[model samples]
Target: MFSICLIGVIPLGTIVYILFLFFDNPSYQTAIHIFARKKCEQRANKNAPYIASYLSCFLYEVIKKNDIVDIPVSDTSINYSGYAIRKNSVIYRFITPVADMPDVDEYNLQKILQNTVIGQLNHYGITGLSSVYQDTTTIVPSVYIDRILYSEEKHLVAVDVLYICTSKDLLYYQNAVRESNNKNKAERTVYDDEV
Candidate 1:
C-alpha cells in the first residue's frame, strides 16, 4: 500500500510547487524561483575556480573603467544575479566543471568576480538556458570545459560583478598601504629635523 502511495506523491508534490508560481504576487514568484534554483547555484559555485583564471583579465578591463582600479586577489566571497532564457522546448544546463563541489575556502579577487557570474547565472534560473553564445559570438577558448564536457560551448550573457563590502583588520592594512603611496606621490620638501 505504501509503495502504491509513493508513486502518486512525487507528481502531486511537483504539481503543487508549480501552482505556487502561478501566484499573483511578483515577490512570491521570485522566492519560488530562487528556491528552485538552489542546485544550479551550488553547481555554479563549483565551477567558479576553473573559470576564474580565464575571466579575470577580461573583467578587470571593464571593472576599472567604472571604478578606480580595483585589483582582485586570489580568493573572495561574491554573489550572482541574472536572467534565464529559453529557446524552443530545450534548455541546456551550465553544469559544474567537476563531478563534485570544490572547496572554495580560500578567498581571492578573481574567484569573487567569477562567483558573481555564477551567481548571476544561478539566481536567474534553475539552470542557465540561452542562445547568446550560439548567435554568432566569437569563439573563445575554454580548455577546462572542453576537457570535462568533451565539447566547447557557452551560453554567456554579460552580468555586472559586485564586490562584497568588507570590514576587518585587513581594512587597516590596506588603508595604511594607500596612505604610504599617496605620501610618496606628493612633492616632498625636506625640512624640520625636530620641528
Candidate 2:
C-alpha cells in the first residue's frame, strides 16, 4: 500500500508540474513580449524614459539566463550598451559601454534602440513587427529618451542602447545547454554507482 501510494502520487505530481509549466510558460512569455512592445511604442509616441528598464525586463523573461544590465550613459557614447545580446562573437554579451563619444543625439539614438528591440523580437520568432512601422512618417519608434536632471551635486543623462545578434551566439548557447546536460548526467551516474 505504501509503495502504491508513493508510485502513484510521485508520477502524478511530476506530470502536473510539467503540464503547469508547459501551459503557463507561453502565456507568461507572450505577456512580456506584448508589454515590451507596447511600452516601447508608448515611449516613442510620448518621449517617455522607461524603455531601458522595460527592455531589460523583456530580455530577462525571454532569455531565462542572462541578466540585462543598465549601463550608465555618462560613461560612454556610441557603444552598444543595451541588452547585451552577444560578446566575443561567441558568448552572449548583453551590454558593452561606449566611452568618450560624441554628444547624445536623441532622435537618431531612439531609432537605433527601436530597431534593436524589433530585431531581438524577430530573433525570438516574433516576426512581421508592425508597431514600429505603423506610421511611416515616424519611421521607427523611439526606445530611448534624453533626460537630464541636476541636483547641484550630481548630473545625469539617459542614453540609448543597441542590440546585435550573430550565429555564433546561438551556437554558444546550444553548446552550453549540451554541456549542462552532460554534467547533470555525470552527476546522476556517480550517484547511482554509489547507491
Candidate 3:
C-alpha cells in the first residue's frame, strides 16, 4: 500500500519529515527533473511559480524509466501548467501515488487543464495532475451580490505550499482502495462506487 508520507509538499527543504500516515507537503523535484531532462529549462524558469503545476502532471517513477516528451502544444499557453507525457505505461512493483493515475478525475479544475486532462488520458495513457496555485478549487454556479464571481473570487492560492497536496488529495486513501477492488472498476463499477 502507498503511504501518505510520500505525499510531499515543495521539494525545497533540506530536512525531510515523513508523515507516514498522511502528509500535505508539496514537492515537484520529479517534475523539475523532467523539465531539465527535456531541456525545458527556459519555460520552467519563466514559469517558476507554476513549475509544480506545469510539470506536476507526471509521476516521478513513470518518467524516470520511460521516455517523456514535453508536448508544448498539448498545454494551454495561458494561466496554468502542463507537463510531459509518458511514452508507454510502465507499472512498478512499488506503490505509486493514487493521484498519478488517470482514473481519479477531478471535479472543479480549470477548463484549460480539463482539456489537457482528456489529452493526457487519451494520448499519454496516464493521468496524475494537480491544480497549480492559480487553478480554481470550486465552481460557483451563481453568487449573491455580496458574493463574487468565480473569476473574481479571492481563493487562497498557495505561494510556498511545498507542492505537498492539492484540494482533493486526501481522496487518495479512498481512491486507492477503490482501484484495488475494482480491477479497473473505478467509475465504471456502480453508478459510482462509494470509494
What's every prediction's RMSD, in angstroms?
A: 19.5, 23.0, 21.4
Error of 3 at 123 (Å): 1.1
Error of 1 at 46 (Å): 1.7
Candidate 2: RMSD over Cα atoms?
23.0
TM-scores for every candidate against the unseen true structure: 0.21, 0.23, 0.18
Highest lDDT, which number? Answer: 2
What candidate 1 gets wrong by more than 4 Å, as runs, is: 1-28, 53-138, 141-195
lDDT agreement with native, every candidate: 0.34, 0.39, 0.29
Positional deviation of residue 117's Cα in model 2 after best superposition, in angstroms? 17
What's the true lDDT of residue 35 in model 1? 83
Model 2 misplaced stretches (Cα beyond 4 Å): 1-55, 59-87, 90-164, 189-195
> What is candidate 3's local distance difference test score?
0.29
lDDT of 3 by residue, 1-195 (tens): 244445443342324444421234335556556667566444323434443443333323222333231212222321222222222111111111221222212221222233443344345543333322222543211100110012113321111111213223223323433544475445354545575
Please tell me which predicted candidate would have the highest TM-score against the true structure.
2
Winner by TM-score between candidate 3 and candidate 1: 1
